[model samples]
Target: MTLAAALAAGAAQTQTQAQAQALAKLNVVAFAGASNLAIWAGQQQGIFARHGLEVALELTPNSRAMASDLYSGKYDLALTSVDNIVAYNEGQGEARLPGPSDFTAFFGVDDGMLSVMAAADVPDLAALRGKVVSVDAMTTGFAFVLREVLGQAGIADQVEWVAVGGGAQRLAALLEGKQAATLLNTPLDLAAEARGFRRLARGRDAVGAYQGIVAAARRGTLAAKRDQLIGFTRGFRESLVWLDANRAEAAGILTARANMPPPVAARAATALLDPERGIFRDLRIDEAGLRTVLRLRSKYAQPQKELTDIARYIDPSIRAATFG
Candidate 1:
């Protein structure tokens, strides 16, 4: 190669290295499922890197563990249920940790692709009564949703509750007959139905509107790294747009990442990108949805405290500054 060409190439390489070195590192934890496709896509497409962040995304199997670790400074941010933040903040968490936690949802993720699936032998919510049901946590996460669904059916007190892990673990327990019914999300729920496991009901259908996954961090972290958090949010929003615009490629990513067949992956991709129930178009915290979450938690939480205010658990300023 000519000397001029070699010099240009070396300069470009040096600039790339400098950008990488300058990136702010952030640690994140999320539940396992198709809900996190945007994060995976962001990493694969260098979205986070472009935003000046080096993000480590970990899959947390248990809600309590995710809470404990986040409280202990193991993660800078967490993509978890807003319910968890409320449960812990109110001292009603399933696995209570010592000391007060100041976690809050700064941005929204999705409407929580949650569904109740049961063994083929079980017919409906009434049948689930006196039978075992699995949840990621007994008091937090979607357990309250399940309780509301059963409660509406006049069978909440009749069923047995068990603490299974995430979607994958709950699906495994259902397949193994360890639990008669459990909640699942996205591709796993699709896969379960393909296997003839009956989808008894969807969470939205049962309980009406609710917030699902959210990007959460401690209040102190938000105060300390406001700019970095905003950058991360912007990158995540861009990733969602990219996924919507690139369906086939996104499905391929889901196929390989979730270990599903091509057809299943395609369907899962379609479901996630659906405007109605998939990822939010704008990452704004929906006040109505937050109220639904608070209402459900207030009803079923141990000690059954009335929680009416949404501001106590969510900070909209970060999202507002980033998006508006």
Candidate 2:
């Protein structure tokens, strides 16, 4: 081979390696379901790659563990309930960490399409009386939302509560009859309905306006990785847009990631695409929703305190910059 040819080939190889190395690496912990379809769609569509980010997504088994891991720098970011952020920031978290948390929600994900599901035999909230209901924790996460829901139904004092880990575990417990009822999100709710479970109430219908999930990270990480975080925000936004436009492909991705059948996956996709209450059309934090979160938390959170300022736990600059 000619020397010129060899030099050209080497140069091309070097350029390719440089481009690959330039992609920013980010570790994210999130719940597993159709609500997180944007993450899966981002990966499947190479949106993250296009924006120069290499994201590693892990499904959280428990909110407390995820919070601890996030605080310890085990993961760079977490896609979890805004309530989790509020709980930890206020020192009311179920799992205590050594130091004060520096976490802040910089992006809005969804309204936590949560549903109250019961065994086939249990027809409604009234029937759940005297039976055990599972939750991630008795004090934090969606447990409070469930409480408010029950209170609205006037059955709050009727049922027993148990901590059964995350959504997947709760679903399994409910299916096996270990628990008479539990809260489920996304495709799981659809799946539960398919398996003969009855949907007693929907979160939005029961609890009213609520902030579901957000992308949170240490304030220090946000400052240090501003460029990469922006890239992620952009990529995530693009993924949501893609999912809106490409339902079939998004459903296929959901089916593969969540291990759901094609029909169930399609229904999940439709639920997520709901313009009114599924994924946020624009990733802007809802003030009313955050207030609703605080109201619910104050009623149930340990060491409960009045939490009116939503800005205390949210940093909207990143989202504003990315979306604006």
Candidate 3:
């Protein structure tokens, strides 16, 4: 068998052994998309098992619900856009949580593989006038991205913004003609293209390097589950390494677990594996990307404050331990 397949089999065996030992349960919440391929591969390939963790992964319909759940002690960690953490922590989020925001990002994933996807018939960006666009929340997620993209295209004020939830739901709205366009990431963006959607603008092309998804947890959770978080970080890093080396296997995992067709999964795997724009192999936060994220939020966030302190949202101890 190939090395990846061998690793897969070995991981399966390790998971079996770990189950008998009653591994620690970790509840992880994330948006639904191909960005999660590594996490899924980690679960199936036994990376987490080798780390002595039993991870339960769930897809949130919206960032509001994900934030609410994460803050309420319902989930142990969240793989989400760093923007959500910033929005909530700054009191700019659409959803109000139970307590003060202590969201901390410990692992970096990718530059938001974000693109403004318009229906095929919509033609150019200028053609979107008077059309309805969708967003996860008007205040958080990639809503700022949508605004900046359309604003530069000179039609920002011509469109209506509807609060759609996650990527799957936004893609559904686009497909069903409920909304004319929205921002989408890999796989879903590929899927939207398959359905005749036009990529009017790419976030990276319009804006620049952007920190997208990251593994986040509350301060209390980080303090209490230090060991478990360490194991998770190690497993997550291993998963990224495996994914980088095993493209075909990673695509297969996306198809089987994320339920994308073979072609879409293959394209997504390729897009996600791109060295410059894909998932971060080193798993280190791109300070440049973080700055871009902060800059956009500072400009667009309501009752806005200048957010320049990167130290406030990041706790790199777990990642430092795993990589060191």
Deviation of model 3 at 135, angstroms:
0.6
For 14-97, candidate 2 gives per-residue lDDT tens digits of: 998898799889999987655478988898788999989888899989998899999998899999899999999999998879
Model 1: per-residue Cα lDDT over 1-324, one tens digit each: 699999999999999999988999999998877557998899999999998899888888898889998988899999998899999899888666778889999998777788989999998888997899988877875988888888889988898888889777888888889999998888789888878899889998987778888999999999998998999999998998999999999999988887878888899999989988888879867788888999988878887899998999999988998878
Q: Top TM-score: which candidate number?
A: 2
Whole-model lDDT values for every prediction: 0.87, 0.87, 0.89
lDDT of 3: 0.89
Error of 1 at 322 (Å): 1.5
TM-score of each: 0.93, 0.94, 0.93
Q: Which stretches of candidate 1 lie over 4 Å from their true place?
A: 1-16
Predicted structure 2: lDDT: 0.87
**Pairs in steric clash, model 1:** none
The TM-score that candidate 1 achieves is 0.93
Report RMSD (Å) for each prediction in the order shown: 2.1, 2.5, 5.2
Which candidate order results from sorting by lDDT in descending order?
A: 3, 2, 1
Candidate with top lDDT is: 3
